[model samples]
Target: MIGVLVTFTQTDKFDRSTLAKIAGELRGPFEGMAGLRFKSFMLDEDGVQARNFYMWDDDEKGRSFFTEELVDKVTGIYGVPPKIEYLDIVGFVDNSGT
Candidate 1:
């Protein structure tokens, strides 16, 4: 598995409500996306940042998703470029059914 951390700094440009609205609007497309195990949209209003975490089935799919075009597109969306980091998943626990 692969973990992707995408951080959008300079989030002070948009208010929390606006950021939340954007996240809400963008959520539908990712539902049931192939190779995606999980995704979360997070906001740090106090820190002026928005971070999104993604868990994918493999590194290749995760890496392929975050292309230069995606960067540009998200830059336009959030009014700033994102800092993307990829990490290997050593272990995972899912207790959704519990």
Candidate 2:
């Protein structure tokens, strides 16, 4: 599986509204994509940090969505640029989407 950790430092002017917009956008559709096998998200005000935690079925699926509208929505809302890192999910918790 392909696990990608998408991280960013929020701009000084970042607001809750923008985070809300991001959540809305990510939960929607684009580029014929449908699902994220597994996902999580986190934000740290003290560090001005935000991350998009994801685990897709494979590299192709992951890259396909990243190159699609999801990337645009992230860039549009974050104000500043972001960085991404790829990793392997050696272990994870799954509750059948509970």
Candidate 3:
């Protein structure tokens, strides 16, 4: 399994509502992606962040997902470009309501 995590933080001029619509637009294509195993998103007001956690079976597919089409799909919705930070996770847990 391969995991990719991304963090999006707004600039001094952006708002959360605007960011959320950009995120919502991504759900359909990402969920339908060939090698994507799991995808989840979350917002943290106190942290002032938006996070995405995705798992893919193939690394290439993961790396190539941010195509111009997807970028347009998101950037077109966003009021401004977001600052994105990519990541690799060493560990995690589902918690499963336990």
Candidate 4:
């Protein structure tokens, strides 16, 4: 599997309601996305950063999802451009059963 981390950072912090709205807005695009395994949304302790962690079956699809228009949309929403990173998943530990 391939993992992608996209972080939106800003000098000013966002309130919880705004974050919730952003998260809500995020859900629609991935509804029928191909090669998607899962996506998790995250927030920094300082509330100045928000992140999306995505797992995908196809690296190309995952990497190419962030098109210029999409980036512009995110930038328009959060008022900050995102920093994206791709990772190779070596292993995963699931403790949900425990």
Which pairs, if any, clash in model 4?
none
Winner of 1 and 4 under TM-score: 1
Q: Per-residue alpha-carbon lDDT of model 1 for 26-97, expressed as tens digits? A: 999899999999899888757578889999997899999998999999999988899999999999989998
Q: How far is candidate 1 from the true structure (C-alpha RMSD, Å)?
A: 1.5
Per-candidate TM-score against the hidden true structure: 0.92, 0.70, 0.59, 0.86
CA lDDT of 52 in candidate 4? Answer: 85
Going through the candidates in order, what is the number of backbone clashes in each?
0, 0, 0, 0
Judged by whole-model lDDT over C-alpha atoms, candidate 1 comes out at 0.89
Worst 10-residue lDDT window for candidate 2 reads 27-36
What is the C-alpha lDDT profile of model 2 across 33-87, one tens digit per residue?
A: 4456767666766647777787887777776666647667677777656677788
RMSD of 3: 3.5
Candidate 2 backbone collisions, by pair: none
Q: Scored by Cα lDDT, where does model 4 land?
A: 0.86
TM-score of 2: 0.70
Identify the runs in model 2 with alpha carbons over 4 angstroms from their true place.
11-13, 30-35, 45-47, 68-73, 96-98
- State each model's CA lDDT, in order: 0.89, 0.70, 0.64, 0.86
Best-to-worst TM-score order: 1, 4, 2, 3
User: Which of the numbered candidates is closest to the native, going by highest lDDT?
Assistant: 1
Model 2's number of clashes is 0
Would you give me the overall lDDT of model 3? 0.64
Q: How far out, in Å, is residue 22 in model 4? A: 1.8
